[model samples]
Target: MSFKNLLLLCSIIWLGVSCKSEKEDPGPSGPGVPASFGFNSLKVNGAYSGFKYNDVNLKPKVRFTFSAPINNATVANGVTFQSASGEKIAFTSVQEGGDSSVVITPSADLKYLTSYSVTATKALKSKAGGMLLNEVKVELITALDATDKFPVISDEALLTLVQRQTFKYFWDFAHPVSGLARERDSSGDVVTSGGSGFGIMTIPIAIERKFITRAQGLERMQKIVSFLKKAQTFHGAFPHWLNGATGVVVPFSDKDNGADLVETSFLVQGLLTVRQYFNEGNAAETALRADINAIWEAVEWDWFRKNNENVLYWHWSPNFGWDMNHQIRGWNECLVTYALAASSPTHSIDKTVYDNGWAGNSTFRNGNEYYGTTLPLGEPLGGPLFFSHYSFLGLNPTGLTDRFANYFTQNKAHTLINYNYCKANPQQYYGYSDQCWGLTASDIPNGYNANSPSNDKGVITPTAALSAFPYTPTESMKALKFFYYKLGDKLWGEYGFRDAFSLDQLWFADTYLAIDQGPIVVMIENYRSGLPWKLCMSSPEVKTGLKKLGFTSPAL
Candidate 1:
């Protein structure tokens, strides 16, 4: 047979397609050779054997084909899989047809990034009760193949692997001009304030994980801060976007051209943590803190209050002031807006602005129960899962409590509600399961939309569940495995897990969003080391803000 055809045949055999090569033709034996006595191995021999197969699946299916019908009783004694380390692997052998090839599947995940061999001994007998004349083996190595598979690693190792890869979005692909994260993989010069804010939080995570040297991360931070210093602002508040190349306004909408207090607040959330993080006595750290302070203190949080009314506005344009007129409402992803506005050392807002403006809305409080989990705040089913992620990335909800809700309780309940709903899967989506869920804003087959229980689309956003690592470790880890080991070929890529995927529609988004990607790195770090939380919370101003808002932090 041609080498190409031989390789194709080997692949078919591995997939459990029954085969009897033309060379061995089970139909009849040579004049002197018995059809049931001599047989070649199902796996491709020498050419592919000397070099370890890099595409071997961790949970491999090995097939053993024969020239003639096999003696079922002797199959078990004849076929075995063994690790190079002398470990005997357990597997189940199946023969779909009485005389077909035997397909062996390991009972558990194999040690990835390592070599192993599958062997069929000569003791095996055929239907004619004659011993097989040759022994056959297949050698392989389990290597990561993002196109269709992933490696199996320890939970801690997986967490580290995930954190490091996610950091690549904020690092390798960050906008060249501003050194800030792009809105998405496709976004070029249009840089987002909110997404950049989330990206800032990942700097420390990358540093702590050793993905980048501290000096390298510090250099990036310097570039980010320098760009922000020159970026256009209205009343000291940054717009929702800035042209990365010129530090000019890139209006989110025609009316949203000037100041975006909510986005600025999100930006400040990361700034404060960074200000707290690089507290070493080094001159560079000292200068970074000073630059961060200049940006932080300059934001007129109270200016967004629109003549000091007790609530914060979302946007204000020099061209169309307050035309957007969106309020920074809560029980949403804007809690950090209020938290940082209240925390600002120079342009701080009164707590009443938070209470009357953010929590004052009718939808601000939801004591309702969904999927047996009572939500302290938010729309039924807890709105899109990001409501718990964005703000809390730096807010540290572990022991944070306020009049409206116990921040930790609220966030965890929100995650669980989202989790249980996906588990119940009343929508009956193709891939909904306990280990495969996470709904939030992402690219859908039709376009982008906020996915939640209320708006149950048959889509799963990896960041939703994976970012909830701190709130729902067990549940999140299960989803992590499902993404990494099962759907990894389609979901994981250059920037870690891609934006979103829909199995029923056979649609997988090959994009990454800064807001979504940042949380995966920061939250996973928070889950493992509490680095971001501890750094953000260490700021005296953050503690002051939480306290003024009538919240008590046991950790504080």
Candidate 2:
């Protein structure tokens, strides 16, 4: 069927048919060691497919012992338990089991009743040689309870809701994933065809693990699987906006005449995000993966592959439209990020994608060229230039990590501190004009600055740009906390999160679309938590790509 499904089958085959046994001496402990008489198991008894069942439940316990003497020669110092996902599980009780064993219960409820594969270990230091340790694993199946209620929305549910919205906003045929209602102008037209209202699919999957349970997040992912199988293009590049009514590629010329690599990168991130859940024979994750693989195979990097002099060109309008074949920093940023993320060191992509025509000095400008570039006074780069923001600091998948990290970290911290301070003295900052205030921040106080367009002094949001912070978490978290918690009133909105920081300017559109929030939610989640990237690394396509890149570790 789908490549993702095929990969899932392969993973199952790999796990079931083969047993990989390492030869290194087992230390003080290893795999399985329950705290109680018998080990515990956690599995979804009735879950046959992705989000197929209503709910699941299970009981878990640990097995251990404590009868030995005070002589430090024999028994293990203590026992420790951990879940497969790396979270610690506390043992409930340590009572005597019959004559030789002991029983132990868990301190908290198991994360979710789906299927928890656990490992317990016992440690003992030895004076004679190396320390001694023992461990064991347990898999238990939990039954589905039709009467069990679904969870209510809470602050903790924000991540999960964003994820579901990511899938729902894009794939309308399945369960209704939630998100900000699509934004609209007074005339009722969507702001930018591909800008504010476009639904950003697959993004939530990339980052939902930061705040929600895996089962809760993926329950919404199945719709994305079904949606992507149906969305395709002949040349391979996914479009900037899928038609709101029919699910086909919506015709839009302002951006790449419809096929934009920047948008495609966001889609690619989403596809990779859901990949991890396909294991255990889940159909949806696998199906979606195959479509994504095909899409990746069909992408034409040739459009951006130019080198008129030595400088690289970014966006390409198939019809020679605006910014056609022009070199722009904004485009380069996302392009490099995607290429590096998808590249294999050994199987390097054809050099053509990086050799396209370069733009004139006037056309190809950056912050350095701001003084000469034709634009509003002190309004360098004008509107929300997606490419420049991600590229300038080297934050993309393939750019200079050190430089990008510095740029993002500094900017993010500055934004947080600004908002933190702004909260106290809103009157001083709020009244100033965007450009005046924006310029003042850089010219006078100098530290944190505002996003462009002057309208968003710091308040009006940049849906796409702000979301890129996931690539740099330490910085992203600072911005998010400031916007949501510190600058609470203006920033956070109802349908989904707003476009940018409120102090700059804030607007909440009625309908939620994929393009704006999808990448933001997914990437931010990944930054706060690494689940999405982890899942992508688990895929065969990524695994093969990494191996080709000369990596010894298994794919992500």
Candidate 3:
């Protein structure tokens, strides 16, 4: 069985502290009023028949009050939460010596989509030594917490479930030996440098969310950093792909068999944010931080400039040096490339490189309006939604500014345009709605394509909308509900929402991509809690680079 299934199975063991049913507090206007109720049994919610099948998350805490004070000592033997088959479900109870109410929480989360009964027998005693006349019971069914089923999982529950499941793509499915994230679910040993970086960013969230223990996260991180220390690099930059088990280069294409500077920057972005998160100065975390710093300081950002040119080149091949000759520039996902480039402590690029290469000197800038939204940069309709995502995953875009733009403003405009285009449905796709919209690079029926207003593929990637939670909450939440509640049976899966779906062709992906999955977890959290943004922006290196590149922000 998978590790996730094993954890679920562990929750069913019979070691629960045991708890019972509940009752509502009998009362009058204030004090000095006599309470009217026969203390026959626990008056659970004021009705003895039993509660309607109330729904909650698996490990819900059920609280009930009584007409009189509860006998704390008698609770353990007097109450029991059990399954239909009479299997006793263990729980821990909380009540003070004279407290009128008791709260019970399952020792472990209850089975997803299962039913259980909380019963209080006449054996329950009141603090005044009064006994119950009969038994009382309450019924509850767990919320649909698994992908195999469906229920009205909305709001915070939906957000939490999405984060947990999408996180599994990195934690549960990561490469076994190297702990690296693969390019796609089926990529096997071909781990990706950029996506692995994204995966690294998610680990601290997993730890904070209690998805994994701190030691587990540390172990996984240690494995990844250790592998990168030994992995093949061109001038201290990791290649786009590497053999997870052997730390060898795996060419993207023949000419691309070398260090991919853009990908390396992405990897470094995740690493730097994570390094800040583990700043408690403990031995393990300290070692990890030092190792990450070594990797960060060693990148030859200046050398990637192709003989001191203003532009940063994307690839550097040991055997085919500068053969790819790809320059990192403007209004795309590579802004992170330049940000990290300028942020490097050792071999740092000049601020002029960013100005002359990424902006100011570049002509890709477009200030035109599309779909009633004016984009500050990138292709019309803001290229793919990922251009808004990739850089800002760690780098806080909100309130961030350079001479060029206020990043949050730029990103928000970009997202609305993408969202509006899908709503426009120029090509008339099947599932384009206010509640079902998002487009970006994802698997299309005909292969992979970057779906956007300009490159329409009738495909919708959940990440495109879901990751924009911080930029557009109401719309993103609508898209999330539509993906999980409406199209969930096919759209949701073991790892999370499947990679992408295209209803126009009656197609849906059963795949997950590292680059796509990471942002969903990080950005949703960036919306709920600015953890990544806070950590990334706090990096002195990032601050130095942003300042050198003529940026300013409250965070700075």
Best by lDDT: 1
Error of 3 at 395 (Å): 0.6
> Per-residue lDDT tens digits of candidate 2, residues 340-396?
333523223442322232222343333323223222111233434333333222122
Query: What local lDDT does model 1 show for residue 293?
Result: 90
Which whole-number lDDT from 0 to 100 does residue 468 have in model 2?
45
* Error at 44, model 2, angstroms: 68
lDDT of 3 by residue, 364-469 (tens): 6778999898888777678899999998998898889988888999999999998888887776655587887888999988699988887887789999999999
lDDT of 1: 0.82
How many angstroms is residue 4 displaced in model 3 relative to the true structure, after the best TM-score fit? Answer: 45
- How do all models score by TM-score? 0.74, 0.45, 0.73
Q: Per-residue lDDT of 1-556 in model 1, one digit per residue for the tens?
A: 6344576568647533323443344444566655544443454321233223544678877766666678788877888788877799998877745575777778898864456888878778777766665576777666443342666889999998998888899899999989988888987888899889989998888887788888998999999999999999998889888888888998787788899887888788888888888889999999999999999888888888888889888888888878787888887998888888888888888888888988999988999888888998888789899999999989889888888888899999999998998888776555588988989988898799999988877899999999899999999999998898877866789999999987555568989999899999889989999999999999998898888887888756
Q: RMSD to the native, candidate 3?
A: 19.7
Ranking of candidates on lDDT, top first: 1, 3, 2
**Which model, 1 or 3, shows the larger TM-score?**
1
Candidate 3 residue pairs in clash (backbone atoms < 3 Å)? 16-90, 20-79, 23-65, 40-132, 40-133
TM value for model 3:
0.73
Q: Judged by TM-score, which candidate is best?
A: 1
